[model samples]
Target: MLTMPDVRAPRLLCVEVHEGRPLSFLTETAAAHLAALAARSVFVPTTTRTRKQYRRIHLPGPPAPYAICANGGHLLVDGESDRDWQGAVARRLAEQCAPLAEVLAHLERTAHPDWTRKLRTAEELFAYVVTERALVPELWLKELSDWAGQRGWSLSAQGSKVYLVPRPLTKSAAVAEVVRRAGTEVVLTAGDSLLDADLLLAGDHGWRPGHGELADQGWTAPQVTALGERGVLAGELILAELLRRV
Candidate 1:
């Protein structure tokens, strides 16, 4: 497995599977910086992970007032999805892009047993499939991306999963709402995936790790800083940069 260097820095436990069972770790430097940033800024978590998965990782700070989950298919406030926002997102997805059922049908038609493990619909807004990354066919992913684009959807092949998400169902939309609610003018974000493009773009400032879908595509924007470190170290670098900038 590819792993980043465990640099000699004070470390903070970020995720744990069970009592005394560590799952993820971050540098204490990054943790303290993030905690200070949270105290002064509107700190919101934006991710492609489902709410359940997002909840598993703990950060050093007060609870975020808002979280964008399921690749922006759902917005969580105080750990729960805001029903009104969810309804609005569903309506927009229905009105603006191919239905979830249609996308699922397309996936079914193009299914390849060599890579696919399981297909799942999330929040009835987007779909993704667990795949053997080494077995994934590049041409197949390209085809899916082209097809989804034609239908106002997008395909993101990241890690062990391939996500098919509607164009309107975006993290930016939910984050914008959070900004409005908080009345904050400054927004900063850090992410490493193609699914995070919108969220990163929408923010006043953002950072992307030197790995994941965005880095693989060589994506960049004027306000976004691209770091060279990859893997877990890339994550730490992002937090460090976030602290430095804000």
Candidate 2:
């Protein structure tokens, strides 16, 4: 197992797990090894999808000690919110920018129904239908960006949904808070989307499966390893990196 020189006693780690996307070992032996490595760890799953939407996915047995839900809105323990932790986030997002209602209004107005599907918004993540990525007028997206910018928010095109999120609302920010509470000494993280980039970069070392948005864009950073793997490999990739740190 790898170790940072300044510390002893198996380092604590914070890991963000992306839902539905599999990392190779996560469903198999690799996850067990990862569990053995850290002093403690938290599974942070960031998704624009809500908690109920996430629940459909089968997380491996003996569930992670902690889990992040609602794209970082709900920090769950035994599948329930750790209110104190999640409340801090809601308070911050509330204070920081326009509400989800306003963002959804803009999305509905800007998005053409034919190209959009599954228009939904959670307390933490707000998104709407977008299809024919190349076909979507540049001006529309730009206008959306401008709209978000005015509200101190951001827009990202991930898969079908055009995400309108608060600039201050980030999976990384919420994950960091949980890490602090866990008193983790080192963090090992992974993900498969543009949204996961922040958490991955913040880790001591991060892995990106070749199939993901970031890797598809290309991995130029020394901090990120393009695993040339996807699905379960995406989950396994992160476990593999954490194994070395263990």
Worst lDDT 10-window in candidate 1:
1-10
Q: List runs of model 1 lying over 4 Å from the truth.
A: 1-12, 16-22
* Per-residue lDDT of candidate 1, residues 143-183 (tens digit): 89999999999888888989998998888888889988989
TM-score for all models, in order of appearance: 0.90, 0.76
Inter-residue clash pairs, candidate 1: none
Compare the candidates by lDDT and give the number of the best one.
Answer: 1
For model 2, state the Cα shift of residue 12 in Å: 30
Shift of residue 221 alpha carbon in model 1, Å: 1.2
